[model samples]
Target: MSRRVLITGGASGLGLALANAFLGRGDQVLIGDLAETRPDSLPDGADYISLDVRSQQDWDAALAHVRETWGALDVLVNNAGVATGGRIDVEAISDWERVLDINLLGVVRGCQTFTPLLKEQRSGHIVNTASLAGLVHGPGMSSYNAAKAGVVALSETLGFELAPWDIHVSVICPAFFRTNLHESLQGKDIAMEATAVKLITKAQMTADEVAATVLKGIDGHKRVILTDRLGRQAYWTKRLVRPAYNHFATKAGAKLARKTRDA
Candidate 1:
């Protein structure tokens, strides 16, 4: 059966990749984005809607469109978020507010608005995009870390609550993949992003590859999905040896700081 899939932040990056993946599978895919979409970026035959994840009115409108058009939603991908980098003390309060509002609260809003529809149907899957940063806290990513960690926690509790309704929840924890997440960075954040790109380009999975993994995880009913080897390593390292993981993270932070200074 062809599923009805809605993806947030679907104009570009991982969201686009995921939308393409579902479209290729013959599912009816709808993209929800704050800005007008780039037609060239998305695959053909995909639908779109204006969605500002921060607003409840936008969420309601998006869902109403889906309900009116398709009658039900089979999958909801809460994949919209931004990356903000700076030392905890240096990052402005505005940065914190924006990051938390979009990354954490955005997911919260999506789940709250869409879960009811899924519950009524008694069948649906919700995939929330988090990050490896959520599992392994690093320096200079205080805001992103807090927002993603909140997403992880929220998804977990949501999974427990929705289990009875057969509305499955999956939290995706992925390592660095080429995406527009870096485009949001500014000032020293740009340097940090550049350093990350240089270090992880070889090892990073493309957004399309991660999208494939997401579908496979959903098909297999995985509760927690890690998109790449690095993400899995980070999760296990933190779980098995916290002290060693923290030591390595601290060194990596120092290296990034030096690189930022030199840049």
Candidate 2:
């Protein structure tokens, strides 16, 4: 059966990749983004809508447009998010607020607005894009980690609640992937220390690969999707050696602090 899919932040990155993946599978894909220009090379039949996931009005308008076109929604992918990089103490409060508003509350708003439509349909899936940082704290990106962690927790809770209604929820926790994230770093009030920058530069995965994993998780009704081998290892290690992981994080933080002080 062909699924009607709506993806927030679908103009680029993992969201765009997922849109293409679903479109290739013959699903009716609708992409919602704040971008003024749609991607030049989207799938032939894909639909694009302007949306700000943080706004309920935008969600309503997008859902209305989708219903008018597709009649019903089978999947909602809350993929719109922002990233911030800096120590917890040094980052501005506004940075924390902004990241949470988009990364965490955006999912909340999407669910609140679109869930009723899914319930009316009696079957659907909700995929929230979290991060590996949600699973384990890193030296920098405190705001991003907090927002993503909240997303993970929110998705898990919704999974249980929505089970009775046959609405599956899955959270994607990808470590890192090659995307326009660096370009999107503007207006964020956080800057990574040198050591923290080195740590983030080591991840190896592409947005398409991560999107493939996301689709697999959706098909399998997985509770969580880890995009790569390293992500899986980190997830298990975080579970098995949580105290040790905390100690390691502390040590890394100390090292980063030293570097910052020296600079």
Candidate 3:
């Protein structure tokens, strides 16, 4: 039987790759995003919906579409998120709110709306796209780091609460793949952005590679999915060797601070 999968921010980047992967596996795929789409870009059998993740009304409507069409949702990828970075004290409060509203609260709304539906069905997956920044903090990414960390925490809580219902909860913590995520930044921190781009461009994985990891995660019912090897190492380094991780982080942070000042 084909599963019904709904992916937010599915017009491009990791979301689009995920939609394609599910579709290739014969699942009914729905692409929800605020970005404009080209018909050629969408997989031939996939569906698209205009979704601004910030709005509850939009989420309800998407859920309704799934309920009406498939009668049940097998997966909900709360993957839509925007980036905002800068020195915490230097950034505007409103900017931080916007980032949290879309990145963190957006995931919250999806879980709130879909958990009941999936619980009633007694089977489903909820995959939230958090970031490596959530696990390990970096300089000049205060808003993004906080928002993704919230997502990580939220996913963990849901893992416990939704287990009895057979609803799998997975949070993806990816070290930057080549994506438009950097372009989505609303920060004035030029050096931070440049450094981020440099580091990400040096990465070996693509969105498709990360999407494959997500597919493996779904099949294995993994609790936490880390896409990049670096992310996996960092996660362990922080947990198992706190002092070394802190020292490394401090040094990297200082270098970034210098870059930011120069920029």
Candidate 4:
């Protein structure tokens, strides 16, 4: 059976890769993004819809489109989010608001909007693309970390809340990977942005690799999917060895502070 899937922010980056992956699996995919028109970069077999996660009107339109086109959705991927970074004191409140609106509440809106349909059908899956920063916050990313952490927390809550309806919820926490995620980054420090870019560029995994792992995780109904070895190790370290994790976090923070100072 070809499942109907909708992915937000599917115009580029990991979203695009996931769209391609689902298309390869013979799943019918509809990409919802902020793009005014369909981008040529979209996968050949997938469909596109103009969607802005921050807008209620857009979300409502998406739900209508899904109902009219697919009848019922099998999967909803709340993958729309912006990259953000800044020190606690230096970060602008507006940046935090924007990041949280898109990263955390965006998923919330999607789940809220789609849950009714899924509950009515009594089966569905929701995948949220978070980040390793959500699990293991290092430094210089207060806004980003808070937003992603909120996503992790929200996903967990939904896992239990939606279980009665047999609606599976999974949160993807991937470490730095080679994607255009850095392009949406917002911050006051150029050095921090550069460092983020370096980490993203130097990562060994590609969006396709991460997307493959995500699909496997969703198949297994994993609650929290860590897409890379580094992400897993970091998560476990923060979980089982708090002292060591704190030490590393402080050290990393100091290093980042020094770099920002020097820059």
Candidate 5:
């Protein structure tokens, strides 16, 4: 059966990849992005909606559109987020507010806005895009980690809270991959930006690969989806090998400190 799916941040990167993946499966895909004009790169059959995730007005408009156009929604992917990294002291409060507003509260707003419809229908899936940093919590990434961690926590709670209504929730934790996510990057340290770009560009996985994993996870109704080998390894290492994981984190912190100093 063809399902109605809406993906935020679908103008590019992992969200766009996921949109294409759903379209490939014959799903009716709606791309909700902040772009005023529809992106020319949008795949042939997918529809577009201008949305700013942090705004209640935008979400309300999107909800109205979905109800009018699709009648019912099968899947909602809250993938709109900004990339950020910086030491707590150096990172401005405004940046913290920005990351939290867009990355964490954006997902919250989506859920709050759409839950009524999903509950009424008694079946739906919510996929939230978190990050490995949400779980691993590396140093010099306090704001990003906090925002993504909130997403992870929110997804887990919703998985249980929405279970009675048959609404499934899945949080995606992916390590760096080749994507335009860096375009939204924010930080006080120039070194952090450069490092993020290098890691993203050098990663073995692509957005399409992550999207494939996400599709499988959503289909299987998995609660927590780790999309890369490194992400999975780090998650388990933190859970099973606390001492080793701590050592690795501190070592990475030292390396980052050295890089920052040099820069």
Candidate 6:
């Protein structure tokens, strides 16, 4: 059966790719973004709404619109997020707060607003886009890591809570993919170290590949979706040797800090 899918941040990047994937699978797609104009060309039955995920009013309005138009929503993809870079010592507190507000609280708001509707239907899926940063600590992304880690926790808790209502919840943990995330990273108050930039740029997968992984995860009712080999390996490494992992991460972080200072 075709599903009614709503994706936040669907104007571009991984969200847009997910929207297209669902549309191609015969699902009805509603894309919510801050973009002023919808893409000029979209698949049939795909719609776009201008939305700010940080706004409760926008969430309410978008849900109402989806409920009215689709009658029932089958999937909600919380894919909107921002990245931050810098040493924690130098990073502004407001930057951490802003990243958390958009990346973590935004997901909280989406779930809180939509859970009731999803419960009424008794069947739905909620997919939150976390990152590899969520599962393990990394250099130069303290704010981003903290936010995504919160998302992972929230998604896991939601999974257990919503299980009674038959609503499946999944957290997506993708390593790096080619996307406009660089622009979001650039907007951060702190500068990205050359090493960090190189690491991100070396990612081989496209946004479409991550999108496909997300769909497969949802279809299989996976609790966590590690979209690439790096993500999977990082997850297991952390799980198998947490102390060793932390020690290594601490050393790497110190090295990155020295490099940033030297630059």
Model 6 worst lDDT window (10 residues): 186-195
Global CA lDDT computed for model 6? 0.86
Between candidates 1 and 2, the TM-score winner: 2
Cα miss at 104, model 6 (Å)? 0.7
After superposition, the stretches of candidate 1 with alpha carbons farther than 4 Å from their true spots are: 36-38, 187-203, 256-263
Off by over 4 Å in 2: 187-202
For model 1, residues 1-263, the per-residue Cα lDDT tens digits are 89999999998888999998898889999999877554566678888888999999999999899889998999999999887777665567888899899999999999999888999999999999998888888877788888999999998998899999999999999888877676666534556556555544555578899999999999988888998887888889889989989899889888867866644
Question: How many residue pairs collide in each prediction?
Answer: 0, 0, 0, 0, 0, 0
67-124: candidate 4 lDDT, tens digit per residue: 9998899999999999888777777889889999999999999999999999999999
Per-prediction TM-score to the true structure, in the order listed: 0.92, 0.93, 0.95, 0.98, 0.98, 0.94
Q: Please, what are the lDDT tens digits per residue for candidate 6 over residues 168-249?
A: 9999999988887766764333446444566666779999999898899999999899999978877898999888888888
Which is the better candidate, 3 or 4, if ranked by TM-score?
A: 4
Range of the 10 consecutive residues with the lowest summed lDDT in candidate 4:
185-194
Per-residue CA lDDT of candidate 5, range 164-186, in tens? 99999999999999998888876
Model 5 lDDT at residue 121 = 99
lDDT of 3 by residue, 196-234 (tens): 777666767899999999899878888889887899999
Scored by lDDT, the top model is 5
Clashes of 6: 0
User: How much is the lDDT of residue 48 in candidate 1?
Assistant: 82
Q: Whole-model Cα lDDT per candidate?
A: 0.86, 0.84, 0.87, 0.92, 0.93, 0.86
Clash pairs (backbone) in predicted model 2:
none
Winner on lDDT (2 vs 5): 5
Clashes by residue pair, model 6? none
